[model samples]
Target: MSMDPKILAFDVFGTVVDWHGSIAAEAKRLSLPVDPNEFAAAWRNGYKPAMAKVRSGTLPWTKIDDLHRMILDDILKTFNITSLSESQIHELNLVWHRLNPWLDTVEGLTKLKSKFTIVTLSNGNLGLLADMAKNAGLPWDLILSAEVFRHYKPDPETYLGVAEIFNVLPEQVMLVAAHKDDLLSANACGLQTAFIERPLEFGPNFSRQDLHREEFTTYHAKDLMDLAAQLNCK
Candidate 1:
C-alpha cells in the first residue's frame, strides 16, 4: 500500500455500475418495439451534449435527473414511442437510479473500503447516486456528486474538491474511473489515477477500442476486483 492516498473517489455510471445493460433490460421489460441496445445508445448519446450545454453556460446548471429526463424525452420522440403514458415515461426516466452494479462491484468496493475512504465523484446528482448505491448495495463511505460541487467531471474543481473536502493534498486522493477523459482530468489536477476498464459499458455490440495503455494512469485494471488486487486492498 502506498499510504499516500487516504481517499479513493470513484466515477459512477459506467465505472461503478453497468448503466447500458440496466437501461436495456428495463427497456426490454417494458416491451419497447425498438431494439433495447439502440434505445440505450440513443439515450446515452444525448448525455454529453446535454452536459456540455451546462458546462459552457449555454444552459443553467441542471441536475442529472432532469438531464436524463430530457434525453429520455428525445429518445422517445425519435423512436415514435407515444403509446406509453406520461407516468410510464417518468418511471422509465428513473431507471438510472436503479442500475445494477458490475458483478465485482460490491466485493471490490468492500475490499477497498477497508483500506481507504471510498466515495463517489460522479456527474450524477446526489439523489441518483444515493438511490443507485442503495438499490445496488454498493458500499460507499460517502456520496459526492456534481450536485455537491456544482461542477462535473473533467472539471478541475470536482477532482480537487475531493482532496479539499478531506483536507488532503491533491496527490493524496486517487480517482478510479473507466473513462480516460475522467482520469486525465484528475491527473491534470495532480491526483493519482486508476483506469478500471468497462469495455462492455456501451453494450455488447459496441466495442470500446479506445482502451489503450496511457501514461496518465497510475494503475490500469480489467475491473474493480483487479484494481483491488493491484492495490493490495485485502
Candidate 2:
C-alpha cells in the first residue's frame, strides 16, 4: 500500500470463476459416470503438482489448458472412463473457457472499472482467459497470462511482469487473489496485496475454515464488491 497502483492484477480461476461448480456442471453435462463433485475435486487436486513441475524446471513452461488436459487424462484413467470420443474429450477440455463468474463479479468489476484499471494475471492462457471473460462478462481492461511471461504464479517474474506491463514500479501494482502464497509472492516483489475470501473455491462440501485476513495481505474482502466498497469505488 505504499503507492496507489493504477493497475489491479487479478488471479483468475478460483478468484474470479466458480471453477468447482463449473467443472462439476460440465462433468454432469457430459454424463460422465463419476460423481461430479469428486470429479471436480480430482481435477483440481492435480493443479498444484502440475505447476510445481514447471516451477522446478522439471517440465517446460506450459499453459494451464495443457496442464488441465494432462490431469484430465490421468483422472479419466483413474476413474476407468473410456467411453468418451476424442471430440468429446477435446470439447470437454475447454470447460475452462466457459467458467462461470461468481454472482458479484461482473457488477463489482464494472463498478471498480470506473476508478481503476483491471487485468487478469492467471496461469490460464490468454485465449482461455479471453473466452472466459467474454463468456462470463468479466470487465477486464486487459487479459494477461502465464503464457505471456512463460512462468506460473508464485514466480517473481509473473508478479513483477504485471508492473512492467504498465511501466510502473512493482509497488504501484496490486495483486488480488484468494490464495496467500500468490499474494505473498506478489508482496515479495514489492506489489500490494488484497485477499479475496472464496470459501467454496474447492467445492461446497469442503471446509474452508480459514477465511481470516493474514499479515501478508494489505487488504482483505468478502468478495470483489466488498473490495470495491473498501476502495471507495462509486
Best by lDDT: 1
TM-score of each: 0.98, 0.97
Question: After superposing candidate 1, which stretches have Cα over 4 Å from the reference?
Answer: 1-3
Q: Say which candidate scores most in TM-score.
A: 1
lDDT of 1 by residue, 135-213 (tens): 9999999999988999877789999999999999999999999999889889999999999988899999998997887
Query: Residue 30 in model 1: shift from native, Å?
Result: 0.4
Residue 61 lDDT in model 2? 82
In model 2, the number of clashes is: 0
The C-alpha RMSD in Å for every predicted model, in order, reads 1.1, 1.1
Question: What clash count goes with each model?
Answer: 0, 0
lDDT (Cα, tens digit) per residue for candidate 2, span 1-234? 455678899999899899999999999988999999999999999999999999999999888889999999999999999999989888889998999999989998898888999999999999999999999999899999988998988889998998888999888889999888889889899899999999999887998877898988889999999999988899
The CA root-mean-square deviation of candidate 1, after full C-alpha superposition on the true structure, stands at: 1.1
